[model samples]
Target: MKSLVFRVFAVFTLVLVAAVSGCGQKGPVLNVYNWGDYIDESVLHDFEKKYNIRVNYDTFATNEDMYVKIKAGGSTYDVLFPSDYMIKRMIDEDMLEKLDFNNIPNYKYINDSFKNLEYDPNNEYSVPYMWGTVGILYNKKMVQEKPDSWGILWDKRYAKQILMMDSQRDSIGITLKYLGYSMNTKNPKELEEAKQALIKQKPLVLAYVVDEVKDKMIAGEAALAVVWSGDAIYCMRENPDLDYVIPKEGSNLWFDAMVIPKGTKRKKEAELFINYMCETDVAFRNTDYIGYSSPHTEAVKKLPAEIRNSRTAYPTEEDMANCEIFAHLGSMLKEFDRIWTEIKSN
Candidate 1:
């Protein structure tokens, strides 16, 4: 009888241990990849607390960097933030999953104008996060003359005082615009002209940079720089001597949006996170922190009058009439990359 009792006690102990281990299992985790310094991190903490889930956040400096990682498929990401042209390229390649609006009701707060855009016409794949234009940021004290044209980037007087974006598309596209060619030009001759223009201007550039443009410009390290409107806003706030202007020759009008990749295993959790980001208070926090143009109508109304009225932050339709949105280049992307390499090498 004592031997029988020992066997039953051992079985009960084993069952209890298994039950305790099962209870300790963690909740669902969502992985998010976005541009560096793009969001308010407290938002991520709040999301975790509200949903009882874990968030693994990561950042990339450029769309190309993000693309290479996702394409390599070594890791899984639940969400991504990519700009307009990259979104179109991903959609064309069937690399993204269609978002279910049923899970994203807060999407209604997004302005109608930001919807049905060329990148995601049906609004099935992505949600607009921020929109802005590319332009020149210059130091008023350093530049004796006002800069109103892209030609100023190539001036010999400013040699070693000019900072250009290291991005392949922005660098090449702006050079094409400066040369009176379409930014999306697939013509070999126009591309060659752009390559030559960049090669000619290379001698004048201080350094090719990305986010570093903000600190360098604010510290008075460079006289002029090619920058996004959002960065211009932040830099101007930090240093009153800085100013931004869209060149008379025209520039690229761009949008960056949040998307779900095809590999995400937690679609429901991913959609929940996206919906949370679209909430009015969350949207306001993100826009207020990043200083980017918000697509949320209610959030825009909540911004300070100065920001709402500022021409640099919210450009008028007339101001943007000459601007163009970048289209997916398909196979032409290879040619652009090749040209960018040659220009960099020279």
Candidate 2:
């Protein structure tokens, strides 16, 4: 009887030890949501190795798609990459958590110019990741005249050879600029005019595209396409005949920033991840891989001379004097959506 009791006790102790060891081997997890093809994902692996924490990375094609998923709220995300205007909307809706910058010392590397922007005025909720101007990407061989203004998108000469962004904000914003209205204008008259302009131009547009813009432009599928600066840089690399220009009338100056959402269960871990991303070496790797404008001042210095000097990648103040950053539209978003549906249907 004593021997049987001893064997039972020994087996129970061993089972308890094994369970504890298994628990110890498991690490914390962080969920990151970002735009498609926006990051050098190798950084995620390096982060996991360095911290012994697993990263669950996900991507969305647009800000709206990300917003919809996050708003639906079944899953939890520690970190998110949202553009300036969307950041404002999220903040207004109380969807983001205030970041404790004390853990993010590497934020010192961010350019002062990129800080204290309209979207996150106090720098409490977000960190600027990448920024650039929206512009027209055109094929030099196909475009006989120099494409300098947004007016060219309306020209009949390029009809059926033009590609527009599928995004409502981008398509409408540029049309607003072409009509001499603010990109962030809330006036119904201005918005209607912009909508009508798009409806009229739809017949000329070859297609409305998103990520496919890079592939299409590279293959010479379209003569002219509205493109983000980073995609323009990537396309220019693949096709020498490609050139990017911010219309003379001006364009949207956009920024994508990292933020912690309200549902984050691991605030400290998220802060650590943001700090790691702000590290100079990591920022350099991302900029080199993604071809977007880095807000990290130190990382910009590490880029090649041509990229550092490229007007398409880094536009000068004179180039951006008339440009404006997008602002949150609040209830007006519904109006924009309604118009967009009309444009697409027509």
lDDT (CA) per prediction: 0.92, 0.93
Q: Alpha-carbon error at 165 in model 1, in Å?
A: 1.5
Query: How do the residues 1-346 of candidate 1 rate in per-residue lDDT, one tens digit apiece?
Result: 9989999999999999999766646888889999999999999999999999889899998898999999999889999999999999999999999999999999999999889898888989999999999999999999999898899999999999999999888999998998888888889999999998899999999999997999999999999999999999999999999988888888999999989999789899999998999999999999999999999999999999999988788888877766778998988989988988998888
TM-score of each: 0.88, 0.90
Q: What is the C-alpha RMSD of each candidate to the true structure, in Å?
A: 5.9, 5.7
Query: In candidate 2, which residue pairs get closer than 3 Å at backbone N, Cα or C atoms, i.e. clash?
Result: none
Show where candidate 1 strays beyond 4 Å: 1-24
Give the Cα-based TM-score of candidate 2 against the true structure: 0.90
Candidate 2 differs from the real structure by a C-alpha RMSD in angstroms, to one decimal, of 5.7
Model 1 accuracy (lDDT, Cα): 0.92
**How well is each residue in 41-73 modelled by candidate 2, as lDDT tens digits?**
999999999999889899998898999999999
